[model samples]
Target: MKSNVGSVDRIIRILVGVVLIALAVTNVIGWWGWLGLIPLITGLVGFCPLYPMLGLSTCPLKKRQ
Candidate 1:
């Protein structure tokens, strides 16, 4: 699939994911914090499944042939 995540969005996701994961690891939060892995993986891959389902995209469209 094409990348639907923009640079800024990717950065934010990574940051938030890291924070949440860290909190979970340090026991600052609950196991729920481990869910951060979702955003982390999506951000790293530059693709979001929900984006298409929700009709939202942070990426710029490429010109079609």
Candidate 2:
């Protein structure tokens, strides 16, 4: 898949995902926190399946010659 997530977006997603996972592991959020893995994976992969459906992207545009 094309990388629709930019550097900052990816960083934020990864951070949030990690926080959620941590909360889940500590039982502060219960099983729902495990869902954080979805963001973590998407961020790491630089792709968001939902963005395509929404026709949105955070990636920077490439310069044309």
Candidate 3:
């Protein structure tokens, strides 16, 4: 799949994911925090499934001939 996540967005997602996971691991939040894996994986992969469905993309447009 194409990467729809731009650099800044990717960073934010990674941070948020790590924070949530950390919170969960430290028992600061509920097990639901484990769901952070979604954003973490998406961020690492640079692709968000919902982005395509929502018609949103932070990635720069590619040049066309």
TM-score between candidate 3 and the true structure: 0.93
> On TM-score, who's better, 1 or 2?
2
lDDT tens readout by residue for model 3, 23-63: 99999998999999999999999999999999999999989
- Candidate 2 stretches with Cα past 4 Å from truth are none
Model 1: per-residue lDDT, tens digit, 1-65?
A: 98999999999999999999999999989899999999999999999999999999999878999
TM-score computed on alpha carbons, candidate 2: 0.96
TM-scores of all candidate predictions against the true structure? 0.91, 0.96, 0.93
Worst lDDT run of 10 residues, candidate 3, spans 35-44
Question: How accurate locally, in lDDT, is each candidate?
Answer: 0.96, 0.96, 0.96
Give the better candidate number (1 or 3) by TM-score: 3
**Candidate 3 wrong stretches, greater than 4 Å:** none
The worst-scoring run of ten residues by lDDT in candidate 2 lies at 1-10
List model 2 lDDT by residue over 1-65, tens digit each: 78999999999999999999999999998999999999999999999999999999999999999
Candidate number of the best TM-score: 2
What clash count does candidate 3 reach?
0
lDDT of the structure predicted as candidate 3:
0.96
